[model samples]
Target: MSVFTLTKEHLDVLEEKKLKSNLKLIEKIIRNDDFYSMDQKDMQYFLRVADVLYRYGKAIISDKEYDDKEIWYKENHPESHLYDVVQSDLRESGKTVKLPKKMLSTDKAYSKKEIEKWLDRILNTALNLNIDRDEIIIRVTPKLDGYAAYDDGSTLYTRGDGVNGQDITRAFKRGLKVTKSGKRGLGAGEIVINKKYFDKNLSEYFENSRNIQAAIIAEKNVDDKVKKAINDGACVFYPFSLIDNWTGHYKELLNDFDNIIEKIWNAVDYDVDGVILEAVDSQIKDNLGSTRKFHRWQIAFKRNDEAAEVEVVSVTPQTSRTGRVTPVAELVPTRISGATISRATVHHYKMVKSTGVGPGALLQVVRSGLVIPKIEKVIKPVEPQIPEYCPSCQSHLIWESDHLVCPNKSDCPAQTENTLVHFFKTLGNNDGFGPKNIEKLANLGVKHIHQVYDLKSHQFAMYGFGEKTSKNLYDQLQASQNIEIEDWRFLSAFGVSRLGGGNCEKLLQHYSLDNLFGASVEDIEKLDGFAKVSAEAIVEGLANIREEFFKVYNLGFNLSITPKLSEQQDSSSPIAGAIIVFTGTMLQGKRGDMEKHAKSLGAKVAKSVTGKTTYLVAGTKVGENKINGAKENGVKVLSEQEYLDLIAQ
Candidate 1:
């Protein structure tokens, strides 16, 4: 039987002019429950049908299933137009009016590291303006998962494509009140139904809150029950300005981020999908302006709880380039989040032994963000399956800390293949050297990155590649050389221990890439953020890769050199050594040029405010909140003209 039934009327209403799918085929696909095996065209069709139906309150699948399918489609078809435009439920037949302001989607971050990187941008901006970083105040609010709209007192509009919206003013006319008795003209907010009211009065009738939300705004006559609910104030327009929030210094917010998020996540009665964080300083907001899709100043942190328990079919070991052996648990295919998960990593052999992650073991898996579903825990433990020998070389494995390691780093076919794959993946400027091609080439005696570069089109054809593919591969190799890539990225592609892109960039800022190999452990350790142990490892890794690196380096790839930190420190300009922040719209010059000018003057330009900032350079249209925030943190505010005058002095 079909999981859920959708009437012909429901399909007709949502179809409008969009592509229509055969209902029987859709039902068959659903009943088969083998979405992973389905063709890409069928998946796309199914997703479109599901999305339209869900939006129109006639869902054939659960929200989780819809989300999973959508995620799958996105991963497979990133360039599809489905991602560029907003997913609106509104039909094309409305009086389209320009909104009071653009309501762009909020940028998202899943981990604390991502948030920290965001904070670093704010700090950098503050440095540029000479604003004290500590003066930066951040505000956090619950991100409502409801129909987004704008309130302009006289008109309430739907958030269609952000800039233009349909006049849904009839929503207010139908007795939908503002939350907390809020006054009109609050600009942006969401129309949300109270969760308690939905559970008590509307749960049986509607599939989900989204269904009721769509019904409340439907052009067709509203149901009497929904009208009554709106009249009772169970459904209301909750403005972002009036939403419950937590405001504090950025550091304090970071220190108690989890606690604060939890406190505010449950502060509202409406459905919330995540927490929104933005700089309270208006200057910071203006300085870090909106991208085409979202504001750089604001971000939403979403948590996914799609998890499943599945039995492990077997545990297999794979060798990585670093000689570390990773344990992969092959499982009975189980759906988690929005994808069918057939395998998950066990972290290491230690986990396999300690958690008894073996055949017949029941494991709980949770998918978060875009990461592969992870084994949360072993639910029903069985005998641990630990490999005594490396899967690739059959070399005896040795224990290193909690990991199983293979000492055969040079000869192992798996390590060699993975290293080649890593190099092509990290170069990121070329394609056609994926795992399958790299593995085939490795089997044919092509083991090194430089060796791959030496191949001719005819040679590739000799390796069993087609003439077309061989020519394409040769062209891609040449393209990789011609494409300008950061010197740090080139170094990182070597996959040295403790020297990823970020660390490489940091090290290159102090010394040139050529000088990096000769640097000592103490030289690296003296830099900020690098510990002694990491310095030691990096020094050793660089030594190990030095010979191969020079061979690749001499092959003539375009590389951009990182500027030395000492060069900036030696400048004798008036603002020399001062940390400055620039905010708002600069009237005198382009912001990029201004930043370059600041750097030339020996001033450390920052993106956000911090305690060490010397001045907050305010430009035209700077917000009062930003000025006040800087003042509160003891940063002297300066107008653009005043900054120019001060530099002259």
Candidate 2:
């Protein structure tokens, strides 16, 4: 009945700490679940206790509860010392050593408004540096919920207090492999166990993956099951560089924020609390440095999960490119989490029929992940409004599992128009093919993507576009072909099932774009990460789009090839397998161009100077402090000309 019963283990872990004096107050606050009434000292102590328990993996409260209290504390006491320094989670007795590189936490934004403000700051900084707004790139990756560690090849260190950490290299000694068999020296990453593996093999014995993670690094004999998990590669060290990522222009990121966040959030098998967004431009990152806790160039978007109750006005059916008729509930406009919500989606027609989601229905709506509005619960039952025909085409809809799907995929205007729009949007380099324009083209008999590309300026005018509009459309089409994009992206634009950008890149890493058409289902299934069902689906989808794919592929569109991984490993380039950091302004050419050139030579380019870096290439206006820091880290400092000469040799 007491809250302390649940947190007794955490207290045992913290027996030697000074927080025990406040145990009665902690218990009282935990029971009441109140943060506003607490004095500043009690509030700060409670936060510290929560944080320490969380770091030790015996968390006394859920992350959301902890965050709510932390936010309250910050609002009431803006100048608290808790914001001044990074906290250490490592409690082992080993002496701490300087980290090979700093491992800062990410600043968090709970809503779109906060994210937009961060974007504005990035824009202003880019403008001051004379960088084009379109040129500013953003990189997003899953924020893994696991033990944070840094691998400098020779030793692995915990992220203790940011600057110094205890050596936890014994984890590797216990046969913990890197994720995807990646080579060592990838710098910062986390030690995580695969979710599926834990559920299947260790769930009955371990309370959670964190318990197994703690056992892996404990200064004692490893548990047999934990050792087995490590040997099986189910538990591994995942470097940030090797993790799945989404990179694009900031415009594309904002335009497709929800989809991007969701995709990246589910990209990995490990548990993730949120998605991390960072400016990818080295100059931007250098300009926006770090605070004591987190970097200014990066932020984590966490879910606020605020909920509201509202009455549904009506249910609307919309058709997607996949021919699924989705049920959308329109509600009386209500605000939650600082944003107005007018509509939310029901899972399917099955949910509508089962839950009676119709006009006058009272329902609970929540901002799922503080991003998408979703119908959480049906509060009052009413006769459900179910559509018998597709909303776009008047074709009969049939139940397929839980979904009501439109069978007339070929003639459905919504499907065709959405497919066309998806192609251009996935291409990410063009702006002329929006929904309205695509619908106009579809009305004029533009069904396939190749047909749209085939439209001449005169043809656009024939299609009833204005003279200037026609000219611009044709120019955009030409521009799409002239502008170079990645081959994986080009393949993904076809919109084949199971052939997303990530899958395409993985496939391309092994097979050439031309060779993919010849690949069989068995061949694809044999590759890592592809199952037989997915391989079959991909083969069937490719067959359905084969003719159209060739037509589009042969359009003379410029595409940069993804280098084969095997060839990259065998590369004889002068700087192959070296981690190099470029600093200061370059006179030979643009810094971005130089970094790209280095990557092409099979070298890893890092944004900051670190101990694992093989070379720090200094250019004009180089800072003495930076060069000296590199030297202290034992990195070889090379002048721009000398580096060029060495690579030339």
Best-fitting candidate, scored by TM-score: 1
lDDT of 1 by residue, 424-537 (tens): 888888779987898799989998888999999999999999999999999999999998787888998887656777788789988887888999989999999898877876
Which predicted model would earn the best lDDT?
Answer: 2
1-649, model 2: which lDDT tens digit per residue? 1123435676776684545766777665554333443445567777777777777777765565666567646753444556432153345556889898889878888777889999999999999999999898999999999999999999999887766788999999999889987998899999999999999999999877888887888788999999999989899999999989999998898899999999999999998989999999999987777655678899999874668998999988887666677787788988765556777667678999999999999998765322345566789989998999888988777665577766553456767665687689889878888867987889878898889998899999998999999999999999999988888889887766667776897899899877798899999999999998678767765666677788888989899887777755455788998999999988898776787678778888776765578999999999775787687567899999998997898
* Candidate 2 off by > 4 Å: 1-5, 16-18, 83-90, 304-649
- List candidate 1 segments past 4 Å from native: 1-145, 157-170, 173-175, 179-183, 186-189, 194-205, 218-234, 239-447, 459-489, 505-523, 526-528, 543-547, 556-569, 573-649
Relative to the true structure, how large is the alpha-carbon lDDT of every model? 0.77, 0.79
lDDT of 1 at 68: 54
TM for candidate 1 is 0.52
What are the models' TM-scores?
0.52, 0.48
